[model samples]
Target: MAISLGLFSSLLSPRETSTLTFTKPSPSSSALRMVRTVTSSTVSHSGPSKIRGIMKPRKVSPEMAALVGAHEISRTQVLKLIWAYIKDNNLQDPEDKRTINCDEKLKKVFQGKDRVGMLEVARLISPHFLKSES
Candidate 1:
């Protein structure tokens, strides 16, 4: 099952020897389709689209700005600052840690609700963040 092209090895350079090791490609339909898909995706794609979401900074309400200490900030940062504020002020209900006792500062941001559930923070804060039309 072997054919000898006698001493042809002596004729090839190191580079040509490596190149000769691989069989010539005759890609099947699926292989070609995969190559096409990969090639299409590797092409460049860039724009402002990458920066248009909750991660993007947006203007905040006056109450929110005062609490977050910034006129404009991202939703993620706002959440972090709000949680920090709650922790610093010891605002969590002792009996049920899931409940938040809104202080005067938090009351303004939370629509004057004296009590807010932990999970409801995000929903209540949604109104404080102005609609961003990006």
Candidate 2:
């Protein structure tokens, strides 16, 4: 009988595996690179920051008046009440979770926005609040 050495030799060979290697950069160089990256990012973001619109309460129109009633409240509150009404009446879209199916009242508040995401609720509703008397 011939002894088989193939299996033994295979076991002796190193198994194939993947490895990730990272080289440590000098402390000063690493710090400089980090500073440069941060500076560039900030500069890029600065333009959008200037374009931001002021968050002032806008005058409530007749349509908005009916939805929120005759009262002054923060835009956040208006959105909360609107969501509450939607929940109570089951106006949420069945097919898409993010879409809101507006009833008559919500349709007015949403300004004909047939489908709205949860995130845009606050932004879209902000225009409905009564602007402060100045």
Candidate 3:
């Protein structure tokens, strides 16, 4: 004899197989829950409630000072200033616009490199800056 399975079968007997039911979470509820969790985690991990000290400007080296003409500046500003100088002096290579032909001042910054790519300009100029350690 064959037995037919029905939805009510499980509810009728203790030995009956259990059926799983899943309900999707509402979008708004899910979003609110996520926001709450993230906010709590951020609050817990946040080190200080308020900033403790004023930011001090980084010191500039003599070589970098001559290049940047400033006592202290951000790395980004230094790059922009160097590019401005290069443009003003017409240091870009005439043959290939992508190449930079260093002048006397730029040569010092570039470690005597006669030619460099535009991409390398930032890296070469960084050495001229005086870091606290060196």
Candidate that would win on TM-score: 1
Alpha-carbon TM-score of each model against the true structure: 0.63, 0.50, 0.53
Model 2: per-residue Cα lDDT at residue 45:
33
Q: How close is candidate 3 to the true structure, as a TM-score?
A: 0.53
Model 3, 28-81: lDDT tens digits are: 565322111111212233465542222334666777777778877767777778
Cα lDDT of model 2 by residue, 1-134, tens digit: 12222333333324322222334456666632211111121223334443223433345767776777745545555666787888889887888778888777777777787778877787877666555676
The numbered model that scores best in lDDT is 1
Position 11, candidate 3: lDDT:
51
Predictions ranked by TM-score, top down?
A: 1, 3, 2
- 1 or 2, greater by TM-score: 1
2 or 3, which is superior by TM-score? 3
Worst 10 residues of 2 by lDDT: 32-41
lDDT of model 2, residue 124: 79
Model 1 lDDT, full chain set: 0.77
